[model samples]
Target: MPRFSIVVPVYQVQGYLRACLESVLDQSYGDFELIVVDDCSPDGSPAILDEFAARDERVVPVHLPANGGIGPARNHGVRLARGEYLLFLDSDDSYTPGTLRAIAERIDATGRPDVVLFDYARTHWYGAVKRNRDAEVFGAAGAEVFTVAERPELLDLFTVVWNKAYRLDFFREGGFAFPTGFYEDAVVVYQTLWTARTITLVDRVCVYYRQRRRGNALRTPSREHFEVFAQYERLFRFIEERPELARWRGFLYDHMADHYLFILRQRDRVPPSSRPEFHRRAARDLRAHRPSGHRLGAHIPRTSFTLLSRAPYALYALHRVAAVKRAGLRRRHRVWRRRLRKVLLALHGRLVLRRALDPRLAVYSAFSHRGVLGDPAAIHRKAQEIAPHIRSVWVVGKDHVDALPPGVEHVLPGSRAYRRVTARATYLINNVNWANDLVKREGAVHIHTHQGTPLKSMGADLLKYPGARRGFSVPKMLRRADRWDYSLVANPHSELVWDRAYPCGFVSVRSGSPRNDCLVRPEPGRRESVRQRLGVPDDSTLILYAPTHRDHRQGGYAPTCDLERLVAGLPGDHVLAVRLHPSLARHHERGLGLRDLAERGLVLDVTDEPEVADLLLASDALITDYSSLMFDYAHLDRPVVLHTYDWDTYLAARGTYFDVTERPPGHVTRDEDELARLFASGAWCDEESTRLRSAFRARFGGYDDGRAAERVVRTLMLGEDMAAVPVVPAPGAPSDVLTRS
Candidate 1:
């Protein structure tokens, strides 16, 4: 018999099934058989399950003839399981890496408890994964082994069966079986907890309970949710049958009252049409099982509970009005706050800094108070190097004061000094625009050292694709561009695009980005140090996977590439470096952290690394999709593979200016398999890649001459005109590469 049998109930989860199966199949403790029960899904889940079983004999796919819900499907899997202990996993959800290994080790240490309760992460479709906050409950009062009577609070750790592992013999002997309907786990979980001979608790994240955008039973409202009433009735009946479990009555009644109130409050789960009937049924149950000493006063407000019990209609109407008023107040507060801040800042700019436009002062910001990094950092450092007389002050977040570079004077954004410098600086340099109301003094120069070369539509193009505008107005952007004294461009193509998209009077300088100067002339020591810090071998082929954010996605975009599978399919000597867009970095980190990738020895997360230049210097190849990094990375003439998995969807959502297929760089792979094949077949850096890179350079790599930083600093800070300076060939690029095809 296998040590553990993982029972997964599958329905319509085709999009996530592969990841779920891969997580299980790749577990560190792999001596387990996977039993996948297919409940006659209407989607392609059955074929997907069969495909997994064909690849790995350890996966057994059982197809049910009829469409049974999750409860029945799980029960079927349990009956077919042939292991000492059985673990239930939902088909849409997954186990974290090393979850089984940790569980098995803990169980062995405790001499095998009847059940082991573990924690779970609530993962959302928008790339947020949150851990359970009630971690103390899993501590079980500081004892490794405890009874439900000792710590009854574990019942509140989400009544989900998937977060726990059950011993097969013990479960069978208890005559445990799930009833057919929704909220079935509540009944089984409570019954097992109350009657288990031995219970153990592990305070580690073992499961990822996914919250899908659609199609979930919980998210979708129907009469089936009414089964919660029946499920609780079953629980109370089980408790009453066992006289030894009498102590749990008070807690159980309190839980029921709270759950009933929660259901009534959740308007989405319980429809308006069903509320009156649901409330009546709930009140009936509360009256029937009103335990002698049970009190809901401690769990919820006394007035609220009393109103819910005595006069629910009044409470319901009051809640509706309060919710609407709260929403309106929140929106009004945000609008008034922004307007007031803008008016005050404009006044400060016009009144206080009117006379402080010092020719020696330059203010720098990147990504809007993000940090002293990006193009702003590059230009700031270059200015300090070449123009010592120019005083440079960086605008940074107050929390990031300690991380500022040595000798650089900094002011927190919105401080008096920051407002004064921003208004009066003779030269204002930034990767993105300053605040919307920033008044540009007539003599003070505003230089737009734009963050990157655009592949997607920007500025005036937002008129065509309003969704891409997010919320900022096109007229506001045009006005902001009009204030620019100068704008930096990487190539003539960018000059044309920027001029058309953001029509303004600013002089467009055909100097490559200062950010790429470090890439053009890399320091050997810095490259070696970065490689060592990243734990990458010196001889390994480092492929950096850096994809762009999708405008269509909620909470921005996440990595579409199956990172674990991507790592597994690559050559052993090659390592993948992942860098997420700044917006989505934190979410992805919390969802699939770097420790797991590092433990696999397949990836190094350079998302938080100080400079993109550093990663560019260390990487031999780049994989991206519509990111401006492509233009910067092309300076190295290394191979680049465009992973355009959502090509059509992305184009439809946020239209691109150029067709990638027409003037492609390196090679393009539309899917994971194609990308993997390119790596495995060693076709990533072939002659075709070189030809495309050469063509890409001829169009986009003309302005970079390893002196863009010096040129920008001279024109803006040192008061030297770029037109007076002689144009030079890029130091490292081939001389024959020319612009305009």
Candidate 2:
């Protein structure tokens, strides 16, 4: 008998099957029988499994006669296994290198436990990887073997069969089998955990839990997702049979409540047409399952739980809006309090101040929060480096206080400390405006390091796009813009745009965007270091698809381009890196299908990445649609393809200042077909594209000479005068003169 039986139930995962098999077959610990159960897969997966089985004797292919679900396939694979331990794997996901070896080593060290639960990295298509959510539970469980009673927090670990290995005899003795249907593994995994006399936890990430582009039961929500209730019911019945496990009732109830609440929140998952029926089912399930006289723990919001438990339909229909409004009102109330505090600080400033502004005090806010890593962050770092005597205090939200970097003093947005710092700070730097009521005191300077190269119209232009500016007050915005002591710009076009957009009296600092300084002139090893951190092959033709957000959509800018088709059409040498606009990141769950494509190695989801510059440095080409990233990537002089599938709708909603076709930096592809044709023909970058890039650079890449941050620091932060700084043209910039309006 083999030491381990790795059971991978394959369905329609032909594209990813090879990678999954290779990951298992190439394991460092070779004493394992690979069970590939082809569950009557409609695709070419059966043929692929046969080929793999032929190639390696270890690969045992089980061709199911009918289309049974994953639960049945796994059960069949287990019964056919001849191994001491059993492990389940999904066809779309892969094991990390040496995972089996590591597990074996841990098992041997621990004297063989009944079950071993490990951690995994949730990988997205755009190369971004999220560590397991319940990593802390593993940390708390440690390496030592213990029962569920000893480490009850083990229940918190994600109930996924793929992330663990089970002792075959122990599992069989427990009479645990995967229940057929959605969330089939939930019942068995829970039972196995509680039934095991000795369970061990390993902190290592042994698997790449794929967030697939499509066809995942969890992602494709339906009434079937409600099957989780039945799975839990089976688990509860088993728990009630075991008299010793009675103490777990409250915890189990809380988990059930959380599961139902999760389903209720995913509004799209519950079809609008079937919502009434869905809510009724959810309400009935919660009522039937929830143990009477059980009080929810502090971790579970009492109000939301009570609402969900009693009237799931009403809670689902109305609670979100009411909750949002309540939260918004509370935020506004805090903002008003902060404004009042600033007013009081201003009054005290006039009465007791010897000097109007304190030169040593510099206040910074990046995206109007206490982040030490954006344009304002670059300015702060430069300021401290250039002038050590200057004390910098960052204004952050209450939640970000602990996340603030050491040695940097930070004040909560509305706290007295913030008011005091704002009142005295001579140099005020931010990517966006400060509080509305806080006027810029005389003698103090405000430097607006505008976040990115604006593609969509901003400031005054927002008034034209009603969808973009529903509640915005132009007069109030201009009033805030009126206080700008200086404004930073990447190019002369932006200088003109800012002047027209704000129409303020501030001097347009012909300095490049401080944020792009790292991209334009990266340090010697910065590019390699960042690429290493992102975990992409150095030789791969890195193509970045960084799209902007949409104004008309409530879920922000979702991808219109078919990512799976685009990935399939791309050259074998190429790897696409994806970065969604920040607004889109807020609503990424709506774009989970894109994640499925990521799982197939067709794209890398770098949307969660905080910095776009790192991805830019690693990429050789860019794919986008009306994003300011086009302007940033133009600085790299790389080939960019415009995937403007929703161009007409986008134009009518959030109009751009200039037509992209009129002076596009590279080729434009309206849809996936056009994109595929370009890649197939090897016309991604040509002479015409290069020429357009030169012209585009000449128009927008004037001031980004890698020294914008230094200039901002020397002049604004250190109180120096460098107004005559020359704005040199890029290396291949055209002689065509475009006047700086």
**Candidate 2: C-alpha lDDT:** 0.79
For residues 449-482, what per-residue lDDT tens digits would candidate 1 score against the true structure? Answer: 8887888998888788866778688898788878
| Tens-digit per-residue lDDT, 413-476, candidate 2 | 8676776788788889988888885657889899988877777889988888899776678889
lDDT at residue 172 of model 1 (Cα atoms): 92
Supply candidate 1's per-residue lDDT for 625: 89
lDDT of 1: 0.81
Q: What is the C-alpha lDDT of each candidate?
A: 0.81, 0.79
| Ten contiguous residues with the weakest lDDT in model 2 | 732-741
Q: Estimate each model's TM-score.
A: 0.68, 0.61
Tell me, by TM-score, which candidate is best: 1
| Model 1 ranges off by over 4 Å | 1-80, 83-159, 163-355, 358-360, 387-421, 461-473, 552-570, 586-599, 642-677, 686-699, 721-726, 729-741
Best by lDDT: 1
